[model samples]
Target: MATELNTPQNRVRFGEFEFDCITRELKKSGRVMRLEPQPAKVLSVLVHKAGEIVTRQELIRTVWGADTFVDFDQGLNYAIRRIRAALEDDADAPRFLETVPKLGYRLIALISSSPNSELEDANHTASLPSTTLPRLYWVAIGASVLILVLFLAGPAIISEFRRPSPQIAEPVSSIAVLPLRNLSADPEQEYFSDGMTDELITDLAKSNKLRVTSHTSVERYKNTRVPLPEIAKQLGVDAIIEGTVMRSAGRVRITVQLIDSRSDQHLWADSYERDLNDILKLQDEVATQIASKIGSHIISPTDARMAVRDVSSNPNKQPIRPLNIEAHDAYLKGRYWWHRRGTEAETRGLQFFQRAVDLDPTYAPAWAGIADSYAVMAHHGGLQANEAMPKAETAALKALALDDSLAEAHASLALIKFSYYWDYATADEEFRRAIELDPNYATAHHWYSHYLVFAGRFEQALSEIQIARQLDPYSVSINTWSALIYYYQGQYERSAAQFRSTLELDPAFGPFVADDLARVYEQQENYPEAIKEHQLEWTAAGRPKDGELLRNAFLAGGPDGYWRRRVSLLKPVGRSGIGSALQLALVYSHMRDREQTLRWLEYAYQEHSPWINFMARDPEFAWLRTEPQFENLESRIGLLASGTR
Candidate 1:
């Protein structure tokens, strides 16, 4: 039935364009235009049903076919984009074709049958070689045309015609918003300026036309004396935004400039002063103006309307909901501490987020931040799973209840589902939904990659992590996690290279990096390097004495003796938490002591350790796959249902 709708037509015309369905060619203003096959097919379908909504499913079935093994959504979107580009049609103010959001596209231009439809036939025929015409005759014809043009227009006309027109500047496709300088007399107000910078990045990132670098990558440049071009080069962006934020009493002023990084030229600059309560409005105005100057298409009709609305008269036009000054301040502080990523910082961040929600109960972002903090604390072993996961889920649900469109909330909930509930299917769906809502949200991609790796989908995991790296290239966590994914996939050399690259970015992450590298080297059977890396990890963790003892044990006993020493040391600390018990199990597995490995694994299961989830894919446990006890443990933990490596 869908094939009937795709039946070839003789010709189709809309606006100044004509498409020859049989020849699969397109023309505008009597000149041929290059349209790729997929785009041309998509255009033909939209033209066939000019005024009706062509659903995405119909387009996929018609163009891609139901059985095609491709990413249907991404492929269809690319095809539609190509069609819009060829037509010079704006998705925001479409004149020829209009997108129907969740539905497919529609041809908005009026279509009519043209009497000159034979033009395509004539053009095709002319493109063929004329065997009957001699070479001399063709040369004479070309000479006559040149003489006629010179005789009619003169030499000056020829020179003028040959002159090139002034070139238009290319649209900025990528940008980095540097940390806003705090110009307040009090230095402690740095949090306010940092918060404002983050807000502007968030607002600009919503535009699908622009690839805005994540806040984590840009934060490193705060107070640095790096040249604008150098900073732009490091961030790998076409443009840079530099600003100064000043606050006095209940009023704030922000001065910002958009610079062309290659030329160091000011593309646009402006300053805004408003009451602190109107800060959200000011941020929206700045983002809208910058996007306009950079020629970024408004992402949606709602965004377009909000951008053009007279905010002075109708403040509700601002996309960001209004927040009380105190609540906003607290939320910003929370985010600052959250970015630090440590037990103390997380605890402090949680307190500030709670304060923010207390001040403004309806603030969805604050609730989302609360959920993020709780999820991180639980995930990093800073808090018990039972104590932290429930609170995280509740806060994430509340945030979604307030604003279902918050990608951060959705991502936070997805993390909870993946790590705590072990609901792989639901977690995968939530991660996809979050990414669909905001493709630029790097955290979603980063976390989703981990989920994929855990599910033994290494190729998909690599794909997602690559996107996250592009968005936040210098993120230490993302870089390290990318290595971790490779490690799980058994790509030891690649995992080592990635870990080394991550250490180059932030050497302070040495301990974590060393731990991962040690495991990778051990897997490669490079025991010496593995032992050295383990020592480095221990020293970085502030246990030089333990490092020395471990090194001595390795020297005296080799791999077996070293692992036995590790198991003995970890056994005493087993009462502290399930983590030590799991570590002992892992060491026992490495020593090839089936009895000891099974014993500690049973202890971990009895303790209800969250680390039990890793048993399915952790290569250390591969040797125990045939064991009945291991199968039973994995089955009970729900990993068997999800598949194992």
Candidate 2:
């Protein structure tokens, strides 16, 4: 029952079934049926080369591509299973894809005519209009096509895709949660409103049925110049949720609207006015309504109760008093600036967090915010480890003591533990506790993923990152982290793609993404691309690391003039950091300045920078690896230092 074919045309005369590749539809006895992408592709591949033995590797390479991270065996099996499901073919008595023992799979089916030929029949003629048509109609069509091209190809494409639709779909599977805007007369209360918006996003994200965009992902659109549909398209969501928060005289009013993204339609709208004690319930209610509007599976009362279970073992404990509004406001301000992550912003965040604690000593959240701010500052080596680490730890502990259920507090503590003390066990405990408190907290998942990566639990790190991505689907930071993980795992192509995707979302991320791509390309032995990506990163970052790396990569690519250009660039900056010395050594080696290379190596050894640890492994230093001076320099830096100590 072997069949033969050519081209991407879908129709295959095999037994009694016809496979339609165009619509990804399968028809048996003229009845339409659904098929998943993988299965459909497998079937198409088989149909196109019927009667041929498709080797396992060929099948995999054709269907999933060689670079695919999926397990080929598992993917092949899954695809065959889906095909069997569609064809009603039993494994024992296969209609097609007969397993050739010890070799590959053979498609045994009668494949006659190209699927495209079937469209020639009058009744089954292609639905599309003929290329040649009435002149007036064609003119109209040309105008329409021109308009379409303008819209699709223009810069407004992104904005247009983000615009809200006016018509709601029957089934809403995707959504964007726009940041809640502050409608308060006093703009100073903006931080509190923003925090509420973030909390709402968290609550919505907990529902697996709804594809809720993360708070951080959508916060950038608070005062967006882009169109709603474009934003929706950028986030890959079908709908958008927007709201305005107003508070006055100990009362809060929140008005929210849900828009179907595709049609720019408003699907649902509601307003709530209540005391702050009802904030938790209000968020839950809003999430429920959104779920209902979007046709999410209704949670039974019992399930709902379970979902809202308290983190504390004692459920009957009295609720704590709300923190001072002034302190909370200050904390929010601090967090607002902290998220900005610039030099001035970090300093301002530290100041505000401190002021918050001063205003209200028992404000646990504010304390945690202070801890996180210090930790972030310490990350960039802007603050002394002793000065920042202890303060961050103290604030985190105080926050936890005041409110053990605060996930942010636990996350901050975990960060402090891992980054400063390297207390793996304590960090793990705190991370677990944070997840228990707020399962949807993206930062908890992100940091936990990072911890697993550093601990060499790469697969677990990937899983954690996946969870973070699910929660923060559109976050540039999360995407960048994913790229970095891939880069670390030596999946250069995938890492480069992810980095490029990050840049698409935020151009400001170009430098970091380009740097990763440069490293990836270098490892791939694509020296030209490596040099190109490095140059891009250099232009974007203009940092010492970027300049040094670009120069080295250019030299590595084997261009004669590159070294001279690099030396000229470095001469202006002077030597700084481990990277600078490494680059200098590389340039010196290229120029046969053995003495200069040794001097730079000595300088690098004197500085115990983390990158120095990679001296033995970095392929860039291979030229100097055999020298006695280089060996001595490496030994001095303790590049082979054992963690057992």
Candidate 3:
């Protein structure tokens, strides 16, 4: 019955426009205007029921048919936009068609059949132009000559039009993988989709030849309506990958498309379906296919063979082991919580990672997750360093033993070596190895920069941190640490600016960043601002009363009084870990109380504080550089003599 409305006699006219149902043509003031087939069909339907409402469901069923597998809401919106464009209609003050809100659309203008008198007038006007036969003969002769010239040059003209544009020919070296859409009927499967997107980003990052944006940067666009080109520009990538993941029963399906950001062209697209157990192979295949399409140099056949080699003796080999379905599920859940970046989330993530390892003890990636969660827990003060760092180190070592080429395990080990064991040389070596295995691992770059900062290699630290910033521009931790690097280099203004930017990304990082900013403010002699920032830090950490007391103490007796009060407050927690003791040492140093400072430094060293590695170069300890106690502490910790800078 809908097909009958697509006939010529059903022509309708409204507001100086005519829609021919038979010819499916839209003409404005007797001139045909271009409209896509879908938009024209939509227009025909709306005009047929002029002055009446047409629901979206009715239009969808009529225009797209019943079983269309697309994002219908987005498609319908796009079609309506096209209709408005073609009709020269304003959606806000619509004259021809009016949107009926959530229902659909309606033709607001009155419609009528085309008058026979107007048709006769149009025919008469057309006949008048044909009366000049002699002039028409001369025009025909001129057109014949033009046609001959065109015939001789047509191939060249056609070739010029058909040639690929510059953007199409340009190689895609960088890409951002947008969060994959979840197509499962159950909302609980969102974790699976997000995890798949993370895995794809990780897989792509393995290609040293391609600069893949980190998942942290791309996760911002999960449900965004922004266009692809705009997102690509923000990520500074040559291309973008958008996809959907659907998990049903024991089978999983993934559909992905690679787009050229500059040209908005689809360079390649494919769909893969496999059992849950084979999902790891599917991920590798998708990554390899995408790398090949982008002309990346890392997808050669030799690299594939190398990826499958034994990694025990060959440290250069890539880890390509498949994961069990149960292990993969637990790993996904672990990562889902891990990205939240809070103490509770870290603890929950650790449990999932443990479950993953328990399900498949050979899964190196799960072990890496366990290591990361434990390390983060320690860093966030959720666990004592002595209790957490050893467990993190054990998990990292086990992961490396299982798969020597696992970059994440190597990075975890590097962090443990630097912070727990104080093995600077071994930490540096592990960091280098992790980066060599996966150059695009932003976390490796982020942590390596910290190592360089402690080693007093400020220039190298700045360079490495900038690389991390480029890879994960939106990562709050990366941005905060970048600011810290600037602070360590005594660039107070730069540090302040970076902290402000990090806060802008997410105010929830206020507690962490405000503490760092407060330090920078204090170093710059901005006491009032430092106190204010410290108060903000305390308030964000759910201790407003402490902040108020500290503020009062600082205002009452200046820096010396502030340190005395801070030291007194920290004394209780100082026994919990080296972090609190190190904090006390810093406060004592600021107070110029060499005795208390040395006492806390001894305690920190005895507890294997990570900050102990920075003592030789820390500006706070500059006053104690020549002190015998400080010298003895440095020597005991094996500080390089050249670290005086």
Candidate 4:
């Protein structure tokens, strides 16, 4: 509510709720509630108003920034709504947050900035109805004895009994790690929290028993106002892990709690603090405890000093070494940006990763990061395959040499071997090894799905992509690939619908999704829709289609003229990172011009274009699948030996 305290304070309690100003987190009855960033700021401003009614202008200046816009009223109303929901304050019967019509709002709940403030709160609530309680009131709800005994003797009583207590919850099969909130004063330290979240997820997922959700899947919940039960349900996870990371004065502290989402029950919670130098080891300790609580092995892996190191060739491999603190910090920042995706973000990520390796060349994860950046650059068509893949392979090889157990490095190596060298055998082994080491690694499964589809293992590909989607349900790339799998399998209607659904989730995907949808339309022989979708793709990509030219060509010679016009319109530039050569080949194959298709296919082969890997499975190329020249190109790509040709 409104604060009367004059001095600045780190934490304050108000009406059974605790607010951490630094972390922007609110907790009621010891349970964390989702308060969005905007609402948190509004609440903060109200708390600082010294119990006075905060006018609209005051709120706008303090919470919505100095630049006033036309929508400030709407934005303020939304924030107030969110704050009320989070605090469970009814506008009709306001208890905590209250609105003042024709003005702004006020926090009526008493704010306590001091430790002894609870006494003040008690005196204030004493005159209210029995329904009203002290601000610091601790209610023991359904699990009263468990709380009582825990306060007295704690969970240790379970060991005192011969049989397990009924209070103990069954071990959950799946869990999602919500993004760790950054409690540091500086906002730049956000990457530290994100990186810690990723590390914790990886550590717990190492357990052969646990099905941990991917960071990409849970990332959408960062600073979200959505309720935990709903978030957990969307993720399809049995339990949820929520936490905060605070860094200050060369010291780090992490606090985590596990919640059974279905019942909204707290299973276990703990906090750890250590010098910055030991942050990596501290992370491992937190993971170890959480793993134990989840009914998994007590020790998950090595020390951040804690990842893969095993290799059969070395019977007694040296234990993975602890990382240099600065390098570890840099590496965390690198991964945060990498997770952001897109060309500019990945480039920024690569620079940070380079800094990491320069600071500590022995850090295997940094080398893996380097491999990932280059590999992604190639995949995004930001760099040529020959240029990017070689660098990726070199870095991945170095990482493996340092610590062969790195699943991320192995996955990166696997993609390079398949997409670049066309070494199917080695790629197969690498992908398997990566998954075996970390079965919950969603990207490994997602990439493996691509290989399966291209190799004509439709059933296996479907299975793998399903698993990938399960682990990373919110990931756009995995969803896109899932749709493409259907397209490759000739399930046109399903693929079209899936692509549309994915595009709905990620509108930025229009440039790519529309292109794929165009193919589905073409396959269905829906010429008008196909042309419209293709035009949408071009316009979204900043290359507006010549609609009149396209329509005229289609009218003159049907699908054949339309495809010929597309070939003429094709630029030297690639589309959605696939080489123009491959795009041309697609057009020619559609026209059933075997000679032109073969010529462009050969060009794609010589360029080592990444899209060439899909030649065996792309339905457009089916017409030319029997041509001698196409067969020769496939043979060169090692697809013949693999039998996919």
The digit string of per-residue lDDT tens for model 3 on 365-388 reads 889999998877776677777888
Poorest stretch of ten by lDDT in candidate 3: 156-165
Number of backbone collisions per candidate: 0, 25, 2, 2
The estimated TM-scores of all candidates read 0.69, 0.56, 0.74, 0.76
User: For residues 445-482, what per-residue lDDT tens digits would candidate 4 score against the true structure?
Assistant: 99998889878998999999899998998787899899
lDDT of 2 at 293: 66
> Model 4, stretches more than 4 Å misplaced?
1-87, 90-170, 304-322, 504-508, 545-557, 573-579
Runs with alpha carbons beyond 4 Å of true place in candidate 1: 1-168, 297-322, 569-579, 599-611
Best by TM-score: 4
In model 3, the clashing pairs are: 7-22, 8-22
Error of 4 at 217 (Å): 1.9
Whole-model lDDT values for every prediction: 0.74, 0.64, 0.75, 0.76
Candidates in descending TM-score order: 4, 3, 1, 2
lDDT of 1 by residue, 144-251 (tens): 356446635662111111111112267688899999977676779888899988888878877878888898889989877677789888778888988777787687
As a whole number from 0 to 100, the lDDT of residue 206 in candidate 1 is 77
Query: Which structure is stronger by lDDT: 3 or 4?
Result: 4
- Relative to the true structure, candidate 2 reaches a TM of 0.56
Which one is best on lDDT? 4
Candidate 4: 10-residue stretch with minimal lDDT: 156-165
